[model samples]
Structure formats: C-alpha cells, structure tokens
Target: MYGSQLWNITSLKVRMVYTQWRKADRQVLSVSYMTNCDLLPLIAYNMPLESILDCKYISFYKFIATSANKFVSYTAKSKIFDYTSTLSKNMAHLMHKYELDIYEIVSLSKYKVKDHSYYK
Candidate 1:
C-alpha cells in the first residue's frame, strides 16, 4: 500500500486492495477460510492495515496543511470525487472527522482561532 495516502479511502479501488489484504492475511496466519477475517493476532475486531492506511492519509494532510509550498498546501484542501459514490470519506470530511477544520488549515495551522469575528 505504498503511496496509499494519495488514494481515495472510500473508493471501490480501495475495496479491491482491502480484499487482497484480507486474503493475504488469512494465508499468512494459516487459518481456515471460514475464520473471521477481521481479527488480528491479539487485537480482535481491528483491521490494522486499514488503520495504518488511514493514519498515512492523515499524516499527509497534516504535512500539506502547513506546508510552505503554495501548490502543496492547496492539495491539502483539494476535493476529489470518490470513484464509488457509495462511499463518503472525502478529504474534507476526513479532516473534519479528525478535527482538522478548513479554517484552521487554510490559516496555516491546526489550532482553532477562538473569539474571532466573521464578516457576512
């Protein structure tokens, strides 16, 4: 999953990757095909691969959100349509989920500015 940060988290393409990961993990663990695919060695109900990929995306966003390069910074705020509209994890929503607001990001930081005036 190299460069997975650039991939759409909710895209169908990602589903394909996930399927492959599940299959590969089962093979590695030598488990029966019927074995629960979502379980980890000691951590049940958590998909570490998915979690890692998500963290990568978040780390990339943080880097670009405060980046000095204009184009790079713009990418932190760019919108991308999901290849599969059925899923809804777009970058903006992801940022909001992780408390990375566009206002704070565009202002070149992660701390929210409080008691600020907003002109209509």
Candidate 2:
C-alpha cells in the first residue's frame, strides 16, 4: 500500500487479490462458507482491503493537492476532477456508498474502526 494510490483499482489483478484476501480471511476466522460478508468485520475487525485502498487513493490525492509545486497540484486536481477517469468513477461509487464528497475524504481517513461492515 506504500504507493497504491497510483493503481487502477478496477483491474483484474486487484479483484483476484481481493478474492484471495477474502479466502484467507475466511480461513483465518474459521468462518463457514455460508457466513455473511458483512459479519466478517464483526469477527475480524477490519475493513475490506479494496475499500481501504480506495480511501488511500483519495487521501493521497488530497496530499498531492496540498503540494506547493504547480505541476503536481495541477495534475492532482486534474485527475481528481476528470469525470472520464477511472479513479473518478471509483471515487463516485465510493462517495455514493458512504454519502461523502471530496471534502469528507480526509475525515473518513481518520476512521477509528478497522472494520468495514460494508462501512455502513
């Protein structure tokens, strides 16, 4: 996750990795195959990896937006607002799920609870 903000969150590799993570979580927690995904957070105390990654992307851009370098700030703001970009689409989905906007990303970043519980 050191530089994951630059990754395409919708890629096939990301999905496969997330699947592996879920399988590992299920095994580690001794959860039955029939167990509810929402209940995983209650049991394991962690958010889904992708969700955290999405948050990290937003946070990293927020950091970039603060840069004094004109080129850096320009690029960050450009990517963030580009409706045609994949990152923006993911951001929209995430924001819709959490009822958040660009300004609130930081607030969510400081979240104390490790669990996603679908982050509901």
Candidate 3:
C-alpha cells in the first residue's frame, strides 16, 4: 500500500507494517521496537511528501514542548478547540502499549476500521 493509504489506517495496525519495513531497510536493528521514530521518517522520506510539514502526533508534542510560552499565550488568546490535553492523553495511552508485531497491527487496523458504530 501507499503512504497516504497507510495513514488512514489506525496506528495500532500500522505498527506491524512499519516493523517489517524497518527490518527490510535494516534501520531499526532492534527486535522489539516500540516507538515509530525510525518508521515515520522512513515512510515520510520515501513517499510523495505533499504536505509542507508533517503535522503528526509527534510534531504536535515537539511544538508544545519547544514553544511552550508561545503556545500557551496563543492558546489563551485564541479560540481554537482545546484538544491538546486530550490528544496528549491519548498519545500517552498508545505509547504505553507500543508493539511492533505486523500481523497484530494489521488486525488492530481491521478492528478499528470496522468499528464505525463505536465512535458514533
């Protein structure tokens, strides 16, 4: 599958593909990798990067950490939806269960994609 198609899939599912891709590239070099530090950049570099910047979850965290004052001031002054806290919580939760099993990750993707009514 293509890079954009992968994004539409849940992160739980993509963990496996990312692992395989990593192993194939001989980049990860670790057996039980958790975070997608290597995977994200690899796919990003290989794929057609239409977006000027990758506005993924990690990028969001870096922005908040690197520009805490500016972010705080802007958020306090602006009327943007305050999903920062919620997103951070969710990211932390996902990080706790990080796995690099490809088959399991694909299963997760299928389950999430099939469960439209759960969110509804």
Candidate 4:
C-alpha cells in the first residue's frame, strides 16, 4: 500500500511538472531535458524504498509550496474555486507528522535528484 502511494505521488509530480512545462513559454526541449534530469536519479537510485518515498514527498511539497499559490489564486479569482488553504493545512499536518521542517525540506529536496550511480 505504501509503495502504491509512493508511485501515485511520483506520478502526480510528473503530471504536474509536465502540465506546467507545456504552459510555460520556455523551450520545450530544454524543459523536457531538465525534467528528465530531475527525475532520472529517482528512477535509478538503489536506496531503500522508504528513503526514496520521503525524498519524493519532500520534492512534491517543495513544488507545491513554490507553485501552488499562483495557481490557487488564479483559479480562485477566475472560477470561484479555492482549496489552497486546505491543501496548506494538510501539508503542514504531514510535515509535522514526519518531523520535517519546511526550510530543510526545500533545501534538501533540491539535491535529492543528484546522481546516485554509486548506489547501483
């Protein structure tokens, strides 16, 4: 069940990033390349599954923290839909449960995708 949840979360991250990339004015090739770079280590790493799960979750949280506000605002203004506060509360609860500080998670999430070839 845990493995399945991890996979779902990872898939969510990929979908989210791809959606953003498509909407971005940046070069598609460059964005695709960068996304691949960010994802390859997670695909190839040999770390314990639990560690990988945590890393992915932290990365997702960082992504949400950085990007969700703009999206939430736009949707709220245009569609009268607003879920950002609820999402933030849920994230905070998860962070507390995991004993993870937001700043630390954001910092460490950046390096989680580095080469893990030595683990192979």
Candidate 5:
C-alpha cells in the first residue's frame, strides 16, 4: 500500500515502527523504512525521539505538537469548567514558541448531548 493509504489506515503502525526504532537505536533501519515505505515526510514529524528530529520536518513536528497541546487544553477545560485556564495559557505559549498556527490547531467540533428524560 502507498504511504498515504497506510497513514490513513491507522496511526498505530507508525507508532509501533517508531517505538521499535527507538528501542533498537537503529537509525539506518528507521531511515530505510521511511524511504522504502514512502513515508519520509509523514513519519518525520511524529517521532517522539529527540535524536530523530530533523530540520526538514521541524514545521510538521510543530504542527503535531501544537495540535496535541491544544487538544489537551481543550479536554482539561471541558472536564473542569470551574478550574483556572492555566492549561490553555501554557498551550498558547508552546504554540507561540513553535510558531504554529493557533487557529489551525484549535478546531472546534459540535458534540451531541444525549437526552436522559426517560431515566427520570
């Protein structure tokens, strides 16, 4: 399958490959897989290992990291509405540091509230 198709299938495989490469410390293997699978760009950004960071994928990493931070902040805010907004502030700082697009990272989605009148 093509890299794009594999990527769309599931992120689990990508994470697994990264984990293996990390445990083995095999840069060659990682590079080979990236090149052979045609996933050089997609895999470049999401690897959590600092040793694997490349200048070519810095922007992609920034996008992923910023979006993740925003997701965490949003989840925290939703679960604890009364709490102070420190999480969001921290996320904003990280986003700024990475020069990430805040609007692109913070996507709002509508959630449906389930009716429970029958239980009453």
Candidate 6:
C-alpha cells in the first residue's frame, strides 16, 4: 500500500505501555490498524515507537508528524509512546542538549476525496 494503491483506511490507533523489571524498563505496545487492505507494515511500524525513543536502552533516530496540506488537515491515525521512563536527573540538567519533537514525510496524491468525510 505504498504507491498508487487504493486504501480504505477508516481509522487507526495504538495501545502501548512500559513495564519495569528490576532496574531496567522495557515497553510493550500493541498496534492495531484498521484498513480495507491488510496492513502488516503499518502494524509493524507502530510496535517500535516506544523502543525507538529509548535513549539509554535503545538508540535510534525518530520522527513523528501529521499529513496536512494547504486546504486540509489530517488526523493522526497512528500514535507513538516513549517508554524509557524519565531521563536521569544529571542528563536532564545538561544545558547543551538538543531535542526534536516532530518530523514530516511527503506523499503525493493523484485523487482528492470529495465526500463529506473529508470536511469532517
């Protein structure tokens, strides 16, 4: 469903949480995507949201964004949860730290939705 495929995605959401065992904490998240077509990739992507954001336990670059255009707003059919618990007090006090809260991906659409759902 990446390129030039018709998708009837009605809604999408995620359910996830962190579990602490001993001194280390790990997160377990369940991802469920509802679409007319099978959504294996979508489900797989959502499952790692928590782990991707973990700096101490797991390290990876992460981005989150909404799909929006000049005339329309896109709701987040996907969600992400960071499950590494809070940063240490020493790291939190660092003055020369950087953080990025959002990122965007571009998609081109050949067709427009003219249904009442688009306005809603």
Using TM-score as the measure, the top candidate is: 2
Clashes of 2: 1
- Candidate 3 has its poorest 10 consecutive residues by lDDT at 47-56
Q: State TM-scores per candidate.
A: 0.60, 0.71, 0.26, 0.35, 0.23, 0.15
Give me the runs in candidate 3 sitting further than 4 Å from their true place: 1-10, 26-60, 66-86, 94-120
lDDT rank order: 2, 1, 4, 3, 5, 6
Q: Which model is ahead, 1 or 5, in terms of TM-score?
A: 1
RMSD from true fold, candidate 4: 13.0
lDDT tens digits, residues 1-120, model 4?
243323433245645754564434235333343454444334444443434544555555556555668985444333212334533443454456566565555555356432221232
Backbone clashes, candidate 6: 0
**Which regions in candidate 2 have their CA more than 4 angstroms from the true location?**
83-86, 104-109, 112-118
Q: Name the regions of candidate 4 deviating beyond 4 angstroms.
A: 1-45, 72-99, 112-120
- Candidate 1 TM-score versus the reference: 0.60
Per-model C-alpha lDDT, please?
Answer: 0.55, 0.69, 0.37, 0.45, 0.36, 0.21
1-120, model 2: which lDDT tens digit per residue?
Answer: 786765667778878988888888889999887777667767898777776776676666666777789998788667767888876766666667666676666444434222321445
What TM-score quantifies how close candidate 4 is to the native fold? 0.35
Q: After superposition, how far is residue 116 of candidate 5 from its true place, in Å?
A: 46
When sorted by TM-score, best at the front, the candidate numbers are: 2, 1, 4, 3, 5, 6
Q: Model 5, range 26-120, lDDT digits (tens) per residue?
A: 36445553353324324553333321222212223233444558885456445323334533443443345444444433341211000111111
Pull out the clashing pairs in model 1: none
Q: For candidate 1, what is the total of clashing residue pairs?
A: 0
